[model samples]
Target chain A: MSRFSFNQITAKPWTLPEMVAGCVAAGVDQVALWREPVAEYGLDRAAALVRDAGLRVTTLCRSGFFQLPGWFDDNRRAIDEAAALRAPVLVLVSGGLPEGSRDLAGAREHVADAIGRLVPDAAAAGVTLAVEPLHPMYAADRCVISTWDQALAIAERHPAEHVGVTVDTYHLWWDDTVLEKIARAGDRIAIYQLADWITPLPAGVLTGRGLPGDGCIDMRAFHDAVDKAGYRGPIEVEVMNADLWERPGRDVLAATMTSFERSFRGR
Target chain B: MSRFSFNQITAKPWTLPEMVAGCVAAGVDQVALWREPVAEYGLDRAAALVRDAGLRVTTLCRSGFFQLPGWFDDNRRAIDEAAALRAPVLVLVSGGLPEGSRDLAGAREHVADAIGRLVPDAAAAGVTLAVEPLHPMYAADRCVISTWDQALAIAERHPAEHVGVTVDTYHLWWDDTVLEKIARAGDRIAIYQLADWITPLPAGVLTGRGLPGDGCIDMRAFHDAVDKAGYRGPIEVEVMNADLWERPGRDVLAATMTSFERSFRGR
Candidate 1:
């Protein structure tokens, strides 16, 4: 059997250390660390303790922007931090369209150029930059990579070991060619993540996500396809919903494990 | 410039005849006719009067099954109706994923098979089949084809000279490959529909579309690509805002024309 990782979207209540412990307790063997938790503790110490914990660090939470200033330097710094942690993938979500620009094509170009400048640092750090295409509802303020073909094309343009894509079903279940793209992406895929899609989206992006089976997503088929696509890497449960973050850490991790198992049953 | 047909999503106050007349008055030369309005006026008479008005019918509003019995036969009847109207395209929106099945892949397979069976009939009548991939949020209860690639695959399955994909911005603006697919589709794209995506989706999908320039879409860049892609078709302004429908019919059409012009900036 293959191992999987789970990332806690928030580090509140029990802190990152406690969440890490909680995930271990829940039978999860790997983790993708986020930025806030690293910020709370100094990076070196956090890396040391995680190494001591006997758990694997699969990927770093993120770094990307279409409209933010100082993004380039910030991204370089993020690569150093990820390198320190020994994580292989750094998630890159291209921030929303620029203010008053109304030019999505321009925004996409900005993201490409930013990646072009930063991929060298990431490559040196031995980290793969994974461009994450967020849901279309988030096109305004979240991310511009909304489909797999676009993500694949971007990754293909870079064509390096350090540049690839993270395919998350929550963000991509609604896309048309997701399965086709997954099969085509083959080994260049960086991360395979899962979250559920729920309606009446809570009036905010951060809180609308549901646990794997709590909502409408058919995660079993997704995992099956990912496995079929030759992606044998960790299937990370990356739930960003504020509701899940607010829940008891142990219960949340336990429930997510159950959902993950259910999603991949005999797939 | 070539004259084109328009599809007014809501035809209130003015009645069907007057709506067609209003579109013609506003320089629209053809139309994508919906079945409900014609049913309200009775079919044979509606057909005769529409034919008499010298307005070309571009597409029929819809025909598919979310979870109904006899879905194939029902949609076959819709194809027959399109034939009667001598419409160039029959818009087939794959019914929503069934209530019990979260199997989106299964739903897509059903859609492809149904279209496969109907392609011969569609070809015999000289009616092209345009598969409309709805917005993802509608996956639960509307059409399941949510990207250009998916629609293209479905079109490939049928391979009828008359089968192609319909690109509606309201349903597809969130996609990353809109320009690429529009260009790649070349002659296979029979229709390109338009609507602006605004936040707080007005509580339901039946309405809540914005006027072209009122939303955040990069309409002009999209325009340049579509034009550069060699699509010299008429820009069909199809808005489904409740607020717009509540206004005077003349007011809605007038505003849509103004927004359409602004959206493309007369390029």
Candidate 2:
């Protein structure tokens, strides 16, 4: 229970203030924030609100579409926002191949280079750039970094504090070898997140994630691996489902917490 | 284009006779047939129709749902069907985990054991059992064999003449290490298939494939790898697109042939 954190995206419609208050009321000590709502509610005010309520910001949701124009400036601003919000990590979902492009190898090379370029800014702002490997299904339209090995390959080139990898069960549970590799990742594991893989993926294949225990993933394996890595950080339940989004934020948080408890029970 | 084979699933709505006639009309010499429609049209009759037309059956579409009850008998029947059609290879899509179970490793072991149990029948019938590794997205509900390594690992334990792996571009393009491994696979490469990966996958994700030139797969890379592996066999175009299925069988075959020609044009 001490490690549980509710990622704001789990309740997609919840504003920063409302998410903070809901987490506080639910007795969750930490919350992970997304950039859009934080900017919508004003970064400083949102930071102050969470701080005043005695909640720790686990991570900033994301900021890495490196394939797009203005990626450098946008990512630099994201680093600044992360620093201002007192979040230790900024998740990076490397964008897919450029439009009309079939060069996945080239896109991946560009991601490695782009992350190399962002390291100084992140280090200066004191925020870890967590490279997240989205599922291979998303390799075409979302993120080309689609495996634990790929994420670690890029992050190993930088200092551990400046660049790291994210461990999200939803994006990685299909992999047979990821658990053992993740167990040895140590400090390179920037943030740990949980989302179960459910069937009948939606059209876009983005928001069909299940709560921790609602699907077939063996969450205890992930928990054991992260523990073996000596990670003592927030375990954020970051599911994104249309049905979950329609519910009230408090209800979603409560459900997420219950799911987390269920997943971690008897451990 | 002597090596080109048009898989029947590319024209989903075409009947067994209509598909055979259409393939003959398109000047196609070889085809890969699925078990469902072949059974519907009477396997023996369907075999005679294609055999009389002098069309060689490249491979049988499938036969490996090891998780189901009666999988052994069903697979034996599939092997008989392949023998009747004179198809050299029987593609195996190892079924997903059982109901309410999350033991992926156990499921994979069951598939290997099930295949081992069927190897004698396959060898006696002169049908090569080609284990197919589906895209990892289908790992939960369709096939547990989700990577080149996993497929190859199981196949290596059996005689190369009796068991091998199916390399489909759509299922494997995202893998960085597969090309080199496939290049070294030698005679263990049983069937080579092509289908491009397109964006915005449809619901269920079973019928969202693209024609060779319609999406992002590099057909030439696959060609080169298989060539280096000393494979000189039929290259079946096995795309399952909803829009393509809506078209007439003749039109679909023409378009698939054109895509195949374009993909292999300069190579």
Candidate 3:
């Protein structure tokens, strides 16, 4: 319970203030936030709201979409937002191939180059850029970084504090080599996120993740790997399911907590 | 055109006789057949129908689903069927995690062991078992083997003549390390398939694959790798799309040929 963090996206419809209040009421002292809602509620106000409620911001949801136009300025703004919110990490989902292009190698190299260019800003802003390797299914339209080795290679190019990898079970459980590599990652694992892989994925394949323990992923195996790596940071249960989103915020938070608890049971 | 082998699933509605006649009409001399349809058309008749049409069966579509109850006997039957059809290769899609189980490592080990046990039968039948590593998107419910390395590792254990790997561009394209590894695979490349990766994957994620040049996969790059490995065998264009299945058999084959030609245009 001490290491648990409620990521705001788990309850997509919750207002920032409502989420803050809900967290405080639920005795959850940590949260992970997204940029859209923060901007909607006003950044400073949202920051102040969480701070006044005595909640820690574990991570700023995302920043990197390097394939888009104006990504440089947009990422810098995201860095500033993370700093303002006192979040220690900003997640990077390296964008997929440019429209009508089949240059996956080029797109991946660009992600590394793009991250190198942003390391200085990240270092100065006191936020670690966590490069997340999304599931390979998303490689065509969402994130081109689709393997742990690929993400770690890019992160190894920079200082650990400025750039590290996000270890999300949902995106990585299929790889036979990943668990062993993750066990050796140590500080390169900036943030550990949990989302189970569910079958019959819906159209677009984006919002079909299962809550931890609801799907076939061996949560204990992942815990063993991360624990072996000496990571004792916030464990975020960040799931995105259309059905979960339709429920009330408090109910969703309760369900998330239940799933999180079930994942770590007997540990 | 001499290297082209049209996979029968590309035209799901075509009866075996209709497909055979259509292939002859189009000057197609090769095909890849599935067991269910061959069984439906009566295996001996289907075999003779294609053989009489002067068509070569490149591969018998599939055999391995090791997680099922009667996999051993079923796969044996599949090997015999492949032998009867004179298809030199039999592709294997190692089944996913067993019902309600999360031991992916254990499941993978079972697949390797099962294949090892079947190698003698495969050797006797003069059929090469082609282990296909499906896209990771299918890892949960379709095939636990989800990378070229895993497939190659398993194939390397047995004599290359008895066991080999299936290289499908759609499945292996997301892998950064695969092309170079495949270039060194040589005779382990039993079958080379082409299916492009398209976005907005429909429900189930099974039938959403694109025709060779209809999506983002760089088919020429695959050709370069396999060519470097000294492979001059048949190239099967195996696409599974709901919309494609709705089209007439001749139209689908024509479109597949056009896409296949376009993919190799600049090469």
DockQ, in order, for the candidates? 0.29, 0.80, 0.91
Write the residue-wise lDDT of candidate 2 on A1-267 in tens digits. Answer: 999989999999887778888888888889999999999999999989999999999999899988899899999999999999999999999998898888888999999999999999999999999999999999998899999999999999999999999999999998999999999999999999999999989888888999998998999999999999989988999999999999999999999999999998878
**What does candidate 3's lDDT look like per residue over A206-238, in tens digits?**
889999999999999999999999888999999
Each model's chain A TM-score? 0.95, 0.99, 0.99
Q: How does each model score on lDDT? A: 0.76, 0.93, 0.94
Every model's TM-score: 0.82, 0.99, 0.99
**Candidate achieving higher lDDT, 1 or 2:** 2
- Model 3, span B1-267: residue lDDT tens: 889999999998999999999999999999999999999999999989999999999999898989898999999999999999999999999998899999999999999999999999999999999999999988988899999989988999999999999999999999998999999999999999999999889988889999998899999999999999988999999999999999999999999989888888888
Candidate 1 collision pairs: B5-B30
Find the 10 residues in a row with the least total lDDT in model 1 chain B. Answer: B1-10
Indicate the DockQ of the complex predicted as candidate 1. 0.29
Candidate 3 predicts chain B with a TM-score of 0.99
Per-residue error at A84 for model 1, in Å? 4.8
> In DockQ, how does model 3 score against the reference complex?
0.91
Candidate 3 segments whose C-alpha is farther than 4 A from its true place: none
Tell me how far the alpha carbon of residue A114 in candidate 3 is from the true structure, in angstroms, after superposition. Answer: 0.6
